[model samples]
Target: MDMKIMRAIELGKTYRDGEKETEVLRQINLEIEEGEFVTIAGPSGSGKSTLLGLLAGLDKPTTGQVFIGENEITSLNENLLAKIRGKMLGFVFQSFNLIPTLNTLENIELPLFLNKIHDVNRAKELIDLVGLSHRSKHYPNQLSGGEQQRVAIARALVCDPPIILADEPTGNLDSRNSKTVIDLLVNLSAEKSKTVIVVTHDLDFAQKAKRVIHINDGRIQ
Candidate 1:
């Protein structure tokens, strides 16, 4: 049987503003196997990103448990959660969160540097893998949106984390660029055997995944 890399049980989240309470997510149960490509699809206000945050250990659920591999992340302290995130999870944001001052290679190497790991050769290989070897020295401002997103993708893979969570990864790109980025993500899951989860509203993009999870009103559909 394939290993279950991520699982959420009875997950829920609520926001409190003064005396008002807003429930964003409720009873979200999910399981993702290693090396599987999965997409969470929903319309606006459907809580897709909120669920991704919980899965990535970026936020705590108000109700149940989240297991990443063998660890129940919901019970881990912030420090330990940070360690888990750095070692086992890679995140790609919709904004392509690249450092403007760092060149392509430097941006990709930043994660390793933060982890106190020096592996320039690995970084170079990732650049090549993403087909961005020629733009290694170019800054984020110097690259096009697609190139910037590619750099972001390469950076996310530098640590070789087993799980990758992308939140609306193609939200900022045109159709052509969106297709390229989605293809790259799919290839990552297939060729590298990475467990990839993407939160997106684009049905066409979500269709590329091995599994599509439709979420509405914070419930799995």
Candidate 2:
């Protein structure tokens, strides 16, 4: 039986500007089981990324709770939440977010180094997994948009986290590259048994997921 890896109950998020307050998410109740490939799809400015941030423990919600496994992350302090994120969540951003000076291998291994661990073999394995063995020595500027995104994915997996949260991973890619990124993400869930969740505005890409959660005007539809 699959375990519940993530959950959100009546989740809500709001931002304030002086006397004005804007709500981004409203009463969001969601759950994701282990190894499930789920896509959160919505139109522009639909709070998809905000929801992702909350799920990733990168932001605080205005109301409700978020859980990862048995941990109620919404109630944890910053240090504790950061630890949970480090151990359980891996995030891939729309911008790739690779270091410009580091080679592919170093960039992917950054997380391990931060934890005072050094294992070049593990980094090599991810490079091969992402089909970037030939370009492992290349820097960010030397890679194409797709290649950079692949590198980002490899970096996200360096810690071997169970859940991958990608926000608009294919946003900057062409059709072929977009397909490549999606294929890699899907394969991670299928072959690696990782719980994968992606946020995207592209409807066709959203369709590739086994399940899609559509959001509009801060509500799930």
TM-score of each: 0.96, 0.95
The TM-score of predicted model 2 comes to 0.95
lDDT by residue (1-221, candidate 1, tens digit) is 43899999999999889999999999989999999999998889989999999999888899999999999999998889988899999999999989998999999999999887777599999999889999999999999999999999999999999999999998999898888889899998999899999988777777788789999888999
What tens digits encode model 2's per-residue C-alpha lDDT throughout 50-167? 9999999899999999999999999999889878888898999999999999999999999988756667699999999999999999999999999999999999998899999999
List ranges where model 1 is wrong by over 4 Å: none
User: Considering every candidate listed, which one attains the maximal lDDT?
Assistant: 2
